[model samples]
Target: MRSRRARVAVIGVVVGLVTLAGGCASTDDPKANPSPPAGGIEGTVWVANEGGHSLSVIDAASSTVVTTIEGIEGPHNVQVGPDGSRVYVVSGHASTVAALDATTYRLASAAPTGASPAHVVLTPDGQRTYVTNYDAGTVSVYRPDLTPSGTIDLGGGPHGMRPSPDGSTLVVANLKAGTVDLIDTRTDRKVAAVPVGGPAVQVAVSPDSRYAYASVSRPPSVVKIDLQTRVVAGRAEVPTAPAQVYLTPDGRSLLSADQGSKDKPGTALSVIDTATMTPAGSIATGSGPHGVVIDPTGRRAWVTNVYDSTVSVIDLPTRTTVATINMGSQPNGISYAPRPPAPAEPRMSVVLPSPPAESSHGDHGGHG
Candidate 1:
């Protein structure tokens, strides 16, 4: 959500008294679901610490930050290459897409983009990477190496988006336009703009690519659109304001990261059943839970609680939070990749200094 500046500003008191800091489940207890074995949950969990100007690299199994790569100026979101070879981040202030070596957290390359880049997505096949330039009203396209390929003028506030599983289409939620742009992946051109109720915040496409779901924040609802016909099929009203939306690996349910405002932060994740396009239930989470992503194994979902500055590990089976991880600052977007282990002695780059990993109490940027 581009709501970061306002949200952080609303609660600047918590941001001070430190650069202050730092979870899931129906019980909202880390112990509700016991921690997994060393290899139980594989891969790396990447989080964009917007306020801290850093990214938190966490080992999924141990729920620990392997390292913090600090220096990104206002990283709104991050995405890992499908093969886990690299991670791409879109910095709103820097107006560039920074690609880092996944193995050593070293900056490899970067390409310029339009104003206020909000989110980044890599095609599942690793063929291309896409970034939403929020203020520019365009989506930036790039080769796998962060090479600029082209740009699609999406018309307004292009925010959260995802490529269809087959990599055929990219479903993008245009916030200011209040519409969803279905862009043909092959051509990088807009195929259609289907209207949502209002201010579409984020989107999730069905596995088959037959349907696309868009979340509207004003009225707090999820709009289900038929991708094949480009029609709004159904809409379900949710209780909390939704940020990022995710379709479970099995495609049975959709999870909405309900990150309400600072005055009334969301305390749960809203669930919608795909079968009926209706409310299934809710999973308790930390305050202002913004970014939610499920693991490759489909057994757990990790979420970033923005206001709390913590990450919650959810045990999918029981819908309970298994662990809460401390983070640096405002953790916005999250992405996971089944990755190999790092070197014996990993070192940080001279450009990217280490940021203090805070608990639920500290870290705020100069929101003013």
Candidate 2:
């Protein structure tokens, strides 16, 4: 979920409303033979430039901007297909999900969504896509080709969410209601809403799908909820108001992007030890750290500092930020697609779809 300052500061933030830099971002380590990336980064990090109304593609190994894809209106969130052939983006201003060809950066098709759309998440199998509608209180489902499937109403501002690794359940944060709702994937039906102590912003489901870690804005904390028992198991305090929660690949630690409000911006990324359910430590980053994704190796993480308009690359093993990439304004969301580019050259492409050209690519796959 985006911060209150962003929605207020940037109209495109689809923050429909509101809307970085660093004092602490760094460079390659010099102690040992420096690796291009701290933890041998791979793939690319796609960032949703909510204010800029574009997407910035970062080359992981080199930690540089390969390109900036433009022409989508107010993209708040972006998700890549498993094969890295497609990218799904939800625009709050357009109230639609635009599926674009990843390589060509062309809008393949677009499907309308609910009011005040927030985040977008695809099923692990990539058969289904879910978009959270904040004002309408529903989640819009779509086929891989961007065709409308159905809708699930959970009420009270459904914002950030994640599907379980097992592909059986979807856990979402209801910002307006201060609760988390679970949906059964097979039936697309409401499972349960477990209330936490504060406004739930974003979520990270455990690799096993047995637990969920929700980022709570107020009180600045992370609450661990047992998915099976449907209750709060533990709560850990963070440095500031966190936006996104991500679990390391090994599931040993949960990284919380401490994105404090613009009026009171935070400068750190909070870490929670999953086993002990306590604060592991904090990593200084750019201001208003928003979306975060860890590398497959679990040794590195990339964080979007919304206020600073920069990304901090964290070396997880040292609990430190090893690099920062300057980006377009107000980078709100981040996703890692673990596939190498064909030519691996820098690209700056802009796709403006004509009325008829805005159509779907053939089906990628059926529901698994």
Native-structure RMSD, model 2 = 7.1
Measured on C-alpha atoms, candidate 2 has an lDDT of 0.75
- Tell me the lDDT of model 1 at 166: 86
Error of 2 at 315 (Å): 1.1
Model 2 residue 240 lDDT score:
72
TM-score, predicted candidate 1 vs. hidden true structure? 0.85
Residue 236 in candidate 2, Cα distance off native in Å: 0.6
Per-prediction TM-score, please?
0.85, 0.86
Clashes (backbone N, CA, C under 3 Å), per candidate, total 15, 15
lDDT of 2 at 338: 84
Off by over 4 Å in 1: 1-39, 340-368
